[model samples]
Target: MTNPQLLWLRKNLFNTWYNSLLTIICIAFLIWLAKSIIIWTTTQAQWTVVQVNLRLFLVGRFPQSLYWRVWIVLAIASTLTAITWGVFSSKQHLTKRQIAVYTFIIAGFLMGLPGDLTSRSWLLLISILLAIGFGIGRKFPKIILPWLSLTWLLSFSLIIWLIGGGLGWQSVSTNSWNGLLLTLLMAAVSIVLSFPIGVLLALGRTSNLPIIRWFSILYIEIIRGLPLIGILFLAQVMLPLFLPVDLRLDRVVRAITGLVLFSAAYMAENVRGGLQAVWRGQVEAAKALGLNSLLVTILIILPQALRAVIPAIVGQFIGLFKDTSLLSLVGLVELTGISRSILAQPQFIGRYAEVYLFIGSIYWVFCYSMSLASRRLEKQISQ
Candidate 1:
């Protein structure tokens, strides 16, 4: 090989006077930025606050006794993750480096905590076990995927019960939720629960029936036209009043409800775009083959419509995840809110940069993962 690295450098960096100068300036800036980051993290940053409050960062003030239940939920999620990967990635074998990185990550959790086996450690162990579960799940009937989605739905319901305390469990109120737990809970719950609602709204908007289409259009427009924060405010202040005297809407539930409704309106629009992108020929062919209108829409149109909008749907999901931070504005302490609370504490009064950076990184990781997954799915669908 004729030194491909040097060739690339020559072509890209030294091709012109401006190019070489610009590259040198960028390199110098990057080196300076790297040094600053290293110095701040090693010597200036007060990491002890973060370490001490890690649990609060992860779960807020969720009772320590209930911590095990959250871990169990994580284990279930890990198993589901493994099963999904095994099913979808059967043709895409993991590289040795990929396997090693996964193993290292799983193993790192074993020693992440000070204890030999803490809740986090145990939860991480389930990830290792997930590989085994994936093998078993992948061998099941191909029809298991839908059932698996239902399983996840049930699992999510169970988690809500476990955390919020109903059905003979200790009654922890929704107000107690905070930190990353609250953020993930609100975002995940809204995304899952809003999907079906969004689909219905989308269908209604596209329906031949004038009343249904008009109503859907009105609702989607009203919700989308208003700011999300305003909706959250309406949900918080107005929801309880709308209920019977004996009923009360939990603050956490209100926040989630507002998010679901708001996001569903956006989701419905994304899905409508998908519906439009589906070819007219597909519907015509289905009808010609003796499929009824309902069958044609459901069997022939819906999948193509949905597949076309997967990227937009995932983008909405990322937006919804970021929107969870707004719950903090309404006085529900999610990850960002919790960080602000900690920063307001007398001892950490001036640590804005450190705390906000940590909060931002957490949000970035989740959003980035969804973004990357959407790209992968878009590729798969195109293929």
Candidate 2:
């Protein structure tokens, strides 16, 4: 190592005898842990359980003929994600380290996948679409940014229609929606629906009207007090009793509903904290400018409030995404649910470590992406 590098490390990590001893111990432990994990992954892990059942892990019982729809959904999501990245980031340039990391991740994914032409082709198509979308966003960001919200709303509807299939397309049963597809769908739907409800609840909680304030308080407190598992149970089982005898909501729909309701309560508290942080003077200034309450809140207060709580809101969203695993316990075959089914198979019965580690990695990827995006968005907003 360079003399400067060694000096810097010595100053930071070995400034004292105790510090040097602790650093050495930590390094030893990390090396041992890495060696053990690598040994197990290389020799003991039976990845065939994942490779053979990749489809089941991804889309579950969704019809093979309709796999095109899943590919389309992925392509659309990937493109939108790229566009969002371009919109938020000032520069499209990547550092060498960032480029290397991204390349390694992409290559690892492709190499790990089974050698299926169709899967590879779909992934390649999505990658191309993502690149194109990013370029368009970089070129025409002002034009695209204004319409981006409406575009996202429309795309979500289109995704649902494609997946669920109605209006001239053959109707696929909701039961067929399982694994990662169901997990993402439920998380997306819940997050989207819950945000507005949460905002409204926050507003109502702080409203001038007593009735509205009390109602919002009651709802938020009741929902917050209950366990998420209880809420899921109520949505899945007890919800049916409230409906007409002939009418029944789809299980997936119910699960999303439960998630939305549960998330909104916590979201309300986060928003309320943000709302409290907003200065009263700002609202008064907006009102003095002849703006109505609605205009003042929407134009002046809401933006600042939401900006203040971006991290909290994004953390809640990540929690909501991970919480979708609970749906497996309630009988919806989401990622965790599908894992149980895969494990139930005769050959893969004892492969719990392999199955769980795979899903755990998938969960980590999404949660970390959300966290990274949150940090970027926060930095952009702060600037």
Off by over 4 Å in 1: 95-97, 113-117, 120-124, 134-146
Clash tally, candidates in order: 0, 0
Q: For residues 159-265, could you state the per-residue lDDT of candidate 2 as single tens digits?
A: 99999999999999999998999999999999999999999999999999999999999999999999999999999999889999999998887888899999999
- Give Cα distance to truth, residue 164, candidate 2, Å: 0.7
Top of the candidates by TM-score: 2
Give the per-residue lDDT of model 1 (tens digit) for 1-383.
Answer: 47998899999899999999999999999999999999998999997677777787888888887877777777777777677655655445667687668657866765465432576568567857776666655466366665877788888888787778877778876667889989988999999989889999999999999999999999999999999999999999998888999997778888889999999999999999999998898888888899999898889889999998898899999999999988888999999888988887788888887888888889998999888777766765575
Identify the runs in model 2 with alpha carbons over 4 angstroms from their true place. Answer: 2-4, 92-112
- The candidate that wins on lDDT is 2
For candidate 2, which ten residues in a row score worst on lDDT? 103-112
Cα lDDT, all candidates: 0.84, 0.91
